[model samples]
Target: MKPAPFDYHSPRTPEEAVGLLAELGEDAKAIAGGQSLVPMLALRLAVFEHLVDLGRVSGLRGIERRGDAVWVGASTTQTAILRSPDLAAAVPLLTRATPLIGHFQIRNRGTVGGSLAHADPAAEYPAVALALDARLEALSPRGARTLPAAGFFTGMWTTGLAEDEILTGVSFPVRGERSGHAVEEFARRGGDFAIAGAAVAVDLDGAGLIRRCGIALFGVGATPLRASAAEASVLGVKAADVDAAELGATALAEPASVPSDLHASGDYRRHIGAIMVTRAWRRALREALDA
Candidate 1:
């Protein structure tokens, strides 16, 4: 199927894009890379009267370090982020998860902002963004306001974005001396959507004990979830002493209730989610110790 007829606008600047969005209101769609939105358009799942393409936008497509955080422009491609020396050095978990998103072709065309706006629970970036405690910068007719990662996702395929808002960029803290990141997932095929996945980041004390740990799960709930129970299990424990098996069990002990899809049963998702969590946690712990 082809997309429904729509007016298209290529905005060279964010100000122009914001103005277009304000003019077009809810009928307008902001597209970058179009990896996600194009598919929606082709399927007619999204019916927009106006398509505001941001590929030409000058300020929304780069990576830079500001103060203590690494700021990624919303339009930055997954491929670009995966290869970024600054991102890898500052937030390796994003690098770890980027390759898991899809094939190289998809990564080359998928924008970080696009993925976040799409808000697919199974996508790799959202969980990493949440685990890293990233801040989303969005522009609107009302002016710009930052949204915390925790408050970004409202539900499946949904976000807090107002009709006239466009995500400008995201900012996240750089990894510290004893910090590490990890991601693990399983799929029927290499490039397929994950049945379940986990991204973990751990900060250790000089004594190698977990000072802080964040475990985020994907494809096991309506939206990607932070595994507070699993994180709590590892806190105060030395990395070497962490019982991964127990941690896995703990994550699945009262697994989140999720709707069963034909691709995988609810129980299977819970099981796989637990395994992914454990793997990510273990790898993060090792990385933290090595730091």
Candidate 2:
């Protein structure tokens, strides 16, 4: 089905974009890349009176390192991220997750900011952002504000962004010398949305004891979930001594709520989520020890 009739706007700058949103009110929406919004519009799942396209907004399309954190512009495409060697070095988990974000063509058009703002509970980027404790920046008529990843996602397909706010960029914190990251997911077929997935990051001390760790799971809950309970289970323990199976179970042992849909049952999702966590934990452990 075709989308309903709407006004199309291509803003030259962010100030112009947000101003349009503020003036147009809730009926207006800011669109970037069109990967998520376009499909929804076509399906009649969403409707907007106006679309303020950011395609012509030059200010929203660059990747740069800001001291310790890697800053990625809101319009930065997924393919651009895959091609960035600097991003891979600074935050390998994001690089690893980018490949699993649908097909190459989708990645070519999909933007990181679009995915985060869309906040699909099953998407790869949100889990990665949560795992890395990435900071998201949103712009509004009020001013710019920074939000921690933990607080940004409020529910499935919902975030902390206000009606007139635009997600400008995100900054992923850089890990120390002995840190390592991994992303593991389970999909019925290649390029399919994950039934369950885990993004894991670990930091090991000199003697191989766990210094710190972060685990974020997707496709099992309303929002990308941080497996803090499981992370707390292994603190200061020898990396090799932590059982992947037990840790995985601990990760999904208690979710706020596991989604149950035609794709999979909640119990099945939890089971698959545990297995993904185990695989990711084992892989991250290897990388951390090898580092």
Candidate 3:
């Protein structure tokens, strides 16, 4: 199927893009990369009178470190993040998660902002962002504001972005020297969307006690869910004494509100979610110890 006819507008700056959105109101949609939007358009799942292309927007295309955080422009491609050694060092969890997004072809054209805005429950970036406590920046005719990742995702395929706002960038707090990260996911094929996944980061004190930790799970909820119970279970515990896998399983022992789709049952997804968390926790623990 082909997308319905629509007016297209390319904006060279974020201000111009937001201005177009403000003027076009609900009739327009901002597009970057188009990996997700194109498919939705082709299927008529989404229709827009005007399509605002943000590819030419200069403000949304760079990766830089700002103070203790790393700022990634909304338009920055997944491939760009995968190739940046500096970025990997600054935020290892993001680096570990990017490769799991899709195939090389999709990653080449997929943008960070695009994925976040698409808000797929199984998307890797959303889980990483939630785990790392990243901040999403947006611009509108009224003004600009930053949103916490926790609140940015309202539900599956939905976000806090207003009709007249354009996501400008995302900022992730830099990992300390003793911090380590890992991403674990299960998919039927190499490039397929994960059935269940976990993104984790941990910081250990000199004595090998867990000082801080973040755990986020995907493919089993309406939005990427932070495993707050799991994180709290490991705090202040000696890394060597903690059975990461057991703790992970125990944390998610209770049934959760997960979707039951054709690909897998809700019970199966919940089981996989626990396994993913366990694998990611163990890997992250090893990394923290090595660091």
Best by lDDT: 2
lDDT per residue as tens, model 3, 123-218: 999999999999999999989999999989998799999998989999999998788889998999998888888898899998889999888988
Measured on C-alpha atoms, candidate 1 has an lDDT of: 0.88
Runs with alpha carbons beyond 4 Å of true place in candidate 1: 253-255
Total clashing pairs in model 1: 0
Ranking by lDDT: 2, 3, 1
Candidate 3 weakest lDDT stretch, 10 residues: 247-256
Overall lDDT per candidate, in order of appearance: 0.88, 0.92, 0.90
Task: Kindly report which residue pairs in candidate 2 clash with one another.
Answer: none
Model 1 per-residue lDDT tens digits across residues 1-291: 999999999989888899999998888888888988898899998899999998889889889999999999999999999999988999898888998887999999999999998999989889998898899999987888999998798899899998778899999889999998899999999989899988889999988888898888888887888877778877898888988878877876555496589999988998888888788878887887888
Where in model 2 is the C-alpha error above 4 Å? none
- What is residue 155's positional error in candidate 2, in angstroms? 0.9
lDDT at 178 for candidate 2?
86
TM-score result, candidate 3: 0.97
* Model 2 lDDT on a 0 to 1 scale: 0.92
